[model samples]
Target: MHYVESPTSPLYSSISNTSFSSSPSGTFYFDDDEGEKSDEEEEEPDEEEKNQSLEEVDVSVLKTFLNDKLHQLGEKPQMEYPELDLIPRCRFRPSDYILIVHYVINKVLNYPLPCDWVEDAEELYNHNPELIAGSS
Candidate 1:
């Protein structure tokens, strides 16, 4: 089989100016134009252009998409962990879910997490005592 990568593919630039061919023996060979460089290899974006591209991404869209995907995973089943009872399970509460989403968004955007972001459920309960009385 012979395969030609499309120029529009994200991986095209990395494997450009090359073609792949497989023989009946299942051996693959890469035919590369060693003397020539693809157009993509010649052009590089400046720092300002990279920043502009990042700025163009809509954070709200990313949040919504991530939330939807998380929800699709379904609620986690409750289980006892006697040895690890001191740990807080963030998957049990709606607010915890939001916190998780925000944490992920902040990570993706290279933003620092809030000082109050708690990983331990016990610590979270101590910070927001009222949460302990509420049922999941």
Candidate 2:
């Protein structure tokens, strides 16, 4: 036995003929009247505009935020690893270590390091012979 749907069936009557249409490519799409912007039509900020916005941000605000984050990091309890104690004692203080990290990060980012930081980093390097061997 085979079941056939007639044009007069309730299912056929409920669906509007205008709801879908076929394109020249033989692909069917819903006919929508609401205007919507496509991805291509949307405007994005240009490099100049992005740079201007970045320039507008206060340096002090960024500094304060960095200081707060660093303070929080310092407040965290230091974890002790017994195996790491086999190495010679590091001469760098916590602040000096932070300075060294900042120096390295600045170098990696290709940003200019401040004169004082360079001097401090040199001093720390001179004081620590172990770092030289590890670096090599």
Candidate 3:
């Protein structure tokens, strides 16, 4: 019996890289008729499972969530800058967002970036302290 999956489920992620010929270990299978359909079938991938894809979906969700929370926290009548500055600044040449992305990629793929990456980002941040201040 083949497992029916939701098209939108992010858990399985790019099955193109997967070969169904080999049974997956620790897989969650479903019968042809199940209560809730796997994202592969429903076309609605689960939010948590989507994170496993190590695709942009997870990063975007995290970034968006951070942005929303940051903005909400920074809302004040005495605000000096627009609401946008409340979030972490990503203005340095390398940019914090880029670092965040890199970190995410490294963590997801279990790969490590060059040792200089952190130093470079820190240097850039030091050069543009205003961005960090504004974000706060």
Q: lDDT of all the models against the reference?
A: 0.49, 0.43, 0.40
- Model 2, residue 115: distance off in Å is 8.4
Query: Candidate 3 versus the native: TM-score?
Result: 0.22
Candidate 2 displacement at residue 19 in angstroms:
42
Query: What tens digits encode model 3's per-residue C-alpha lDDT throughout 1-136?
Result: 1223357643223332333211122232223243445667544555655454333234444455434433444433232334344446553333333443556445654556655323335465455565444543
* Top-lDDT structure, candidate number: 1
TM-score per model over all chains: 0.35, 0.29, 0.22
Candidate 3 error regions (>4 Å):
1-52, 75-111, 117-136
lDDT per residue for candidate 2 within 1-136, as digits (tens), equals 2223358843334333325333333333454543555668645656654444333444444344345444544544234434444445554333423542465335544568765323235555345555554554
Span of ten consecutive residues with least summed lDDT in model 2: 9-18
lDDT of 2 at 80: 46
lDDT-based ranking: 1, 2, 3
